[model samples]
Target: MSKDTDNSNLTADNSANTTSSPSNDRSANNVAPNEVTFALAQSHFLVGDISANADKMRQLAIQARDQGADVIVFPELALLGYPPQDLLLRPSLSGRIKSALSALSDIQDIVMIVGYPHVDHHGTFNSAAILHNGHQKGFYHKQFLPNYGVFDERRYFDKGRNQVLFDYKGITIGLLICEDLWEKSPIADLKQQGVDIIVSLNASPFETGKQDMRKTMLTQRSREHKVPIVYVNAVGGQDDLVFDGGSIVAQADGSIAHEAPRFLDQLMLATLNVDSNTFNTQEKAPLTLSRESEMYQALVVGLRDYVNHSGFGGVLVGLSGGIDSALTLCIAVDALGADKVYAVMMPYEFTSKISLEDAQAQARRLNVSYTVCPIFDAVEGIRHTLAPLFNKSPADTTEENIQARARGVILMALSNKFGHLVITTGNKSELAVGYSTLYGDMAGGFDVLKDVYKSQVYNLASYRNRLEDTPVIPERVITRPPSAELRPDQKDQDSLPDYEVLDGILTLYIDEDMGYQAIVDKGFDADMVAKTIKMVDNSEYKRRQSPIGTKISQRAFGRERRYPLVNKWSINS
Candidate 1:
């Protein structure tokens, strides 16, 4: 939280950048009277591609210099992307980062602030440094390490204590990385010190309506401390996390001057004009998106990048003619062209004619590759094999699972042979209570809607189709009740609560972290709450084995949703 004009008061190093220019964007009248502008650089950073990551930043530093940016800030762990996790234990990683910093210093005239982990005599710290021409200007460790939810920063990084302020082109700047801005102390200290502006570098993960929260936090802080703030966030997906990169600028009067696009990589340039006469942000064209649209866009970018970056030529989705798969198909088609997506309609004896018709219709509307892969022969083969073991019982879920597993095998064989990423379409409700099969429906390279609740899946599907010209997802998918089509007369309602009621309780139980008694007290049926809690508790093992999906909510599968698979505690007892 470096505020005020700390850098404006510093002595110049005899460079042309330090000297005042009449054409400068901001006046150099304050204590640190040098004019400075910064660029927020982001990329679709790959996991463990240290050299490539450093190279991208080095190029960006050069580009920023050409664009008149005095200082350039990059995302958290810009050298390795977010949640490098235990890779920090490599020991040589820190040395590579420092060397990268030194190389940047050798290149240009502008200060570059790049985020990386620094190991020193004090301890290991999540750090960002200010560098110009290979010399260190200042370095600050991230103070707050968020341990809750998907973040386990405390396990990897030692807490940063000191706030490092530096002189950049005659202006004082303080740096805070990611979680440091979430707490009060960093900004509060900057306010007390009376610096100019606080520039926060972040790799915050995406969730529904997160951009609104970013605006509110930055604007409120700027108004509270009477200081402007530039928030730069990382973009693209890393495992389950996706960064929206909606880098925003908020002035001291609680007004937003500019915002970057969501879920896409773009350079954001915000020029703030400041002097004793007026402290105003020169307005740039504002980019706007509704909350629903933002969430949808995040999913599309995430799916596209994950599929393409992983070196897959295209994607394959099992179209059950359900909302989840239909929405996933639309997103895939939108992200990669219709040429890159392939929809497989794996209809079975139990699959309704409407479901089959809808699947074919969606494929035609989207104009992607489509084929019907009937599983009757494959399922019958498996059933004949199981018949030898005294199979005298009535056909139950086991028979139904065989059908799903047959479809899964067909998709996976295609995945192995053709190198297409299979996207699972199961929603959060089915995943929450073991409604999905492990090797059957859950088999896939990725799950696009794993975090989306069943109820929201319908809305998102409708919204996505409406966003496009024609209705890609048929009307029957939205209006029809969800069913696994395992048995002749089976529906999802036979095993679980209705999705509207079920998703409501799940949001309370999982996202809100409410206990069983608390959920029951919220006017749900006591018996229903007890049974659902047991199902959720029992399903921990299945969720653990589920494919890592993009986390669109506060608590999604994989990193965020972690429960002991062998737990025996019961809240109702």
Candidate 2:
């Protein structure tokens, strides 16, 4: 759904045509239900890694059982990973998933609630299986399938209709999916019908302090509906998204009993005593990570999982010893260990020897593998190759691009031969103004700092290096004019405005979605704004091919950011 679409009224009546078996009720009465503890198991999963994911589920189930959990709750799409866009179209994979579900059901001694794609006569469904009493007792289809901003859920699954309550060990627990809890009607309707608790399975992506927002919303909902809520979310990275599995429980009186940390995967066992006693909450919410720390961890985990899950042995970066490449290398080293990172200094005619020296020094300080591969010969060869086409005319921007492309191609060849992934160092500000070349500087399997702006890139680089504290990036590298070193005397300021001014205009137009005239009204140069917008508008095709990056802003280039390639629309409108 778009940001504007709200469908809270999609609640369906689950009034019983037939009641629970009297024998079942008798069985429930005979069993003395004390403090019942259930485990919310968060798994780190890779997309389409079926057997590995099932093995993970089986292990979590066994561990939860050992920890005295009556039921183990997994996240949405735990079977195949979340947002399995085109993978759902494979019929054999769907069959394998169903077989895997059956295999999981065969495990004894624990009830498992697993999210997966279900194939039915009507179509495929985003569903969770209610496994108990030696059989699949019930199934719930996700109703509010999101279809916006990296979620194309509507493209695959069918919506559910009924809301049924399951009686397990004498507790009436209502089942809902991720987006279902976002809608108030389902939980409210269940509470009106006298449900005890809501068990929601989710794969919600991490976006800064989304956990705090979830806590606030669920706490208010618990107060609004007079029912406790247990939220279980998936943990890991899939392409651009990183799920911070912060499984939490909120009591009806607006108190949170248990809260898990963000980023790390865990199996949390929460015990809730439900009875005819007065409706009053007794537990306090656990202290979650502060907002700054939360965003920091999100970036760390995002880079970590992106490296590990993509099957890259290490990372190869063309380091210019500038703040951008320095920060990118620091993050890569931190994420994939210094031993796994291979840095190459690809200096051209404009490159200063200070850049090469500082980069080598910083690599030594970090204990990373460093190499120097000057591109002057390759530049001449490329100029030689294209000379016949250009009739040996004066070299232009095309020649500069040839140099960048030579570096990119060499990095990619290293990536191919050695199983290392090339990390692109261009930040969002450079990408926004078409300062980075396509198939040249932008050719990489992933971008570590693509969402960050240029000025913020310098700050983060400085923070990571800690010259005042420990020094990860060399001081000389930080103290230099920003340059791509494409020509004999080239600098970033020559092609674009100062980063301070450029980042400000891009923020207003890109993040806030402001129009051209509105940006001009903010006292920015009209000609600069027009030029920046034109560059941004022309770079749509390049952005489309760029690897997915973690979303740090309201509008990131990977998923939340969408644009038309063949368009003449100007922001003046």
Candidate topping lDDT: 1
Full-model lDDT for every candidate: 0.78, 0.77
Candidate 2, 220-256: lDDT as tens digits: 9888887888899888777777798888878787777
Q: 465, model 2: CA deviation in Å?
A: 3.8
> What would the per-residue lDDT of candidate 1 be over residues 1-573, giving only the tens digit for each residue?
222244433322211123221222323223234345667785666767877887888888788767766668888888777779989878787787777666666765666777877887777888876665555655778889999988898888888777656544434556788788878889888667655678888888899878888888888888888877778889997777788888877777778876777777776656555453123354565467776687788788788778877899988999988777889898889889999999999988888998888899999998999999899999999999999784587877788788889999999999999989998988899999899988888999889888889888887877876876767788888888878877777778988889999998999999999998898889999889888888899899888888878888987878876778886688846
What is the Å distance of residue 195 in model 1 from its true position?
Answer: 1.3
* TM-score: model 2 vs. ground truth: 0.89
* Residue pairs clashing, model 2: 1-147
Alpha-carbon shift of residue 323 in model 1 (angstroms)? 1.9
TM-score of 1: 0.92
Candidate 2 segments whose C-alpha is farther than 4 A from its true place: 1-32, 276-296, 466-469, 521-525
In Å, residue 244's CA in model 2 sits off its true spot by: 1.5
Which of the numbered candidates is closest to the native, going by highest TM-score? Answer: 1
